[model samples]
Target: MAAAKEGRKAPSRKSAAEEQLPGIEDARTAFAPALSGALERPRSMLRALRFRPPQLLHLEGGEAADRVALALWWAALLNCDDPEVMEPRASAMGPCLSCSSCLRLGVNMHPDLILLDGREGSIKIDDVRGLRSILGEKPHFSRWRVIIAAEAQALGIEAANSLLKVLEDPCPDTCFVFTAPQRERLLPTLVSRGWVVTLPWPEAGRPLAEELRPWEQALGRFVSEGRGWLDMTAARNGMDAAKAHQILLIGQKALADCLAGREGGMLAAVFRRMPAQALMQVDELFVECQDQLQAQVSPLLVLDSMAARLHILARR
Candidate 1:
């Protein structure tokens, strides 16, 4: 029963595509090549593949940057017989992928690694403090500790400042890798501290899938689903306002209808097509949407949050 309820809330592909058109497809194409390359490359040496690391790696266009990040992490771990001492356990895992490989690596048991998650709400000060405490402790398994903040943008002012202190003067062997859909979500101080790697959009005029007019078919499906399940709240869940507003109202209705017609558990299957980490973020956005609706915040802000969430959910 719980699984069923959870399944219903999941988003569908058709609905996801309907939420937006050319814009969403544009993001899809942006990282298509990179994604294809990574997925096809069998689990091997990702570092040897000319993989570039941008301090502020921007996964702007599609889910390409996200894929690249995941691949890099996996490859590094696989190759590093002793990543436990290098990358902390906290930095190793993420919101989506449940690949417990790290557990076998003794990473889950490592005290040096700190997993900072803010996908539920703003990453609390307590969470930050805990990480600091872990960092303060001498290295248990590895010389360098790692911190992977999945939703770095969720850091409140205090939390961000606290993290900034460590990022600026990180321990001699400490490395921090933060991920967010948009750079604007982070403070300038944080952004400036690291190298910036922006994910590129797919080459213009890329070939379209054979199903329908690539843009039109996808747009129609996404918008229809989004509108049907459209909740007018949750506008502030995203980085931008106006853009998010447009997405929520457009996508809500479409999403609901797709679910209604499914025989059973279809939505989950569609979502499985998306990246795992991305799926977690999308779920967070949906939760925020509901919160905004109940809080009766700016209807526009709520809607925008929904839109941005859907946009991320839809991107490959």
Candidate 2:
């Protein structure tokens, strides 16, 4: 969901019987009144409210552009007990509200919906270790557990590998909902373990901006031409996706440094601490890099090509 608008009033909870009487049965009746308060009052009232359960909805965007609308439709069901489906309105932004709204909505302190982010913009191995520490404990509040990773592709190799273990063998109550512009950019092993859903682009027409033209053109061709690497790389940049492919090249070089025992401080550390499976993936990266070089593909383009081929190669 897009970030919340600044200065919006907090949701109210004057009618939140859930706060007055906390229980599953009461919680069901309270949603309507609380929803009314949400519409009537400022956003702050939600914090005064009580607990709510966690819900995970995986949505994918197709070329049609209405994915955001479709996802929001599903989000409405999160608060409601009814199983009936409802049409989504474009106005409701999925949980991307300000911290203030989160507080008001009884959602700010959800132990189940854990929000994980990188300490310094890059997810490190420590991040995964931190999650591992909490893996076994039952959720303190919500029924379902969710882990949202923004910029999921920025996960460092060690971090990603560590997460793979959990993904392969998730706790019974856990649900992971990851968002990325292009799923193909993610590690194939990781992608394969989860339900892959696409969010179609918005249905509304977009004006062709000058800066976006190149990206639009490139993406269009990549998709139509089955240029997997080019498409994946261009999408990663939130534009052309070339940056991830470029970073993969850097990873390849780093792996070569490790295999050769060049004795660099960082390389030596990676060789020491990285798990065997992760090391093997790094080794495979070099082989792919060699192939990319032979094809005269730039380092920045190697990531997509490798990711694309992995669909076939990954099976082996």
Candidate 3:
């Protein structure tokens, strides 16, 4: 028997009888606004998935729980039985909250849904092997079998290689969803095989570590005073690729917060002074710096180049 139909009661007509899965509601609420704003691109991509679903879907960024909630919504929509829910009407923008499949997912009682929580521990080769038998079978009640691997960065090398092979040749009507803080954290081979979606950071904003405060302050000064404020010699001495990466990450977050009209101290205040277009350019610069660092560029060189570019933008 397929996992979907076994060890679960038949679908009930009264959706109210089911209780929501723990933490799902809060996760949903946290990401709700972003779905329409920061997450709109991913949401649009979901429409395409409805026609030809990808074998592997990788959602990078955002809180792990929030990503899971979005994945659940996708699963619910793919399997929803309500006829009226098929249209793209405003009223039908998301999963039909009252349908049997939606209800089943709400409470996490759906037989077709498999959740591999990496937070528990490392995902081993054994865990990947266990899913083979389940994937071979057809979905019992829904149109698609959804396997959500939350915090997929925890997957060990063997497990990632095992899962990568599965992604190369996926079973019919099955989708594997992986969530992590960033795609760079996952195996390059695995990342290459999936349809990757970049979600926004949560609206609440991620707090920067206290140790990063000096770097943050330096960023503010550089933005406000242009290249004159930067000390290339000191930066070269004090910065490594890892530290540079963290600084860029912090800058990206502050820029995002500024765009969202959130008050985020000095960094945000500096970002706010720039026009939206300039801020976007800064965001792109940060991404470029990250890519350059990944490609083994000298951290000091990248920082100097970034400072030069920001100086021009600050003048504009």
Candidate 4:
């Protein structure tokens, strides 16, 4: 996040979610009802509302775009105050896109909307302390103070302990949202406290979230097609280290699903065509890639190793 300053004007460089992103509309649609509930009967709902309309939300799974879009959208809806209504309204109408709050939030320039990117290393106690200090203040204009945290799993032990205090007695006007690749990444106590809403996979991959990116989809196709000679050069070249990591994860899941009698289902052809022993060896290599990624090894080298091994396996 930009430096912790009072009444800070949002930075010119915006997060991807600030711009109108791919899955943002879907996010608005998905969470419209909750926003509407907040607005429709604020008095009634507040007295009766349980955790369903979550004060603290754990947005798990989905692409970076999907998570960001949803988080920003939810924040905008909770804060929008435009009196205008759209034609042919949704059952749970969201923020009027034309409202000042909506416009500001669209660019993440809202004074009350805070976004915290927990560093990959760790989100220490000081970071949470700063956040608590900020939340201690009242919203400048919007009714709700919103904070969307990405990579929240990195919250260190002390930070997590401090945050638990806030969660136990949350501010009435404050809402918190967390987005992580996997739910297990967060501590169990934190996960248990928030309402976990698994956002749908990016439109590119539905149902099982399979076929997320070009390389991952191709990896799945190659495995299922079971063509021993399937060229992996395109998939290999298209990925950077991060993308390659995702591709390997998808490949690993495919192998596991196939082994568990999903042979004729998701990866039917690939499972049938590939030798069991060869697939197992490839799976082991992929696991090694995962360990290397966590250990901060060079991604290209990891991918190159996997590709070479797969090539040799195919040749055999």
- CA-lDDT, candidates in order: 0.43, 0.42, 0.70, 0.58
User: What is the lDDT, from 0 to 100, of the residue 134 in candidate 2?
Assistant: 72
- Tens-digit lDDT string for candidate 1 (1-316): 0011111111112333232323323333432344454333322222222122222322223332453444235322422333232233334222221222233122322344455654444566778787755655544443335466755655667778887776655354455656554566577888887644444433433323243232233333443355422333322344333233223322332333333443222233345455657656665666576445333355455654454456446654
lDDT of 4 at 308: 58
Off by over 4 Å in 1: 1-79, 82-110, 200-301, 304-316
The estimated TM-scores of all candidates read: 0.44, 0.39, 0.56, 0.54
Count of clashing pairs, candidate 4: 3
lDDT for each residue of candidate 2 in 52-124, tens digit (9 for 90 to 100): 2122323333321122222222222232222121113322232322222223223323334454542125556
Tens digit of per-residue lDDT, candidate 3, span 268-295: 8877888879988898998788777655
lDDT score, residue 21, model 3? 38
For every candidate, C-alpha RMSD to the true structure in Å: 17.9, 17.3, 9.7, 9.4
As a whole number from 0 to 100, the lDDT of residue 42 in candidate 2 is 17
At residue 123, candidate 3 shows an lDDT of 65
- Residue 245 alpha-carbon offset, candidate 4, angstroms: 5.7
C-alpha lDDT of candidate 4 relative to the true structure: 0.58
Q: How does candidate 1 score on lDDT? A: 0.43
- By TM-score, the better pick of 3 and 4 is 3
* Tens digits of lDDT, candidate 4, 84-124: 21212332455665555676666566778877765334456
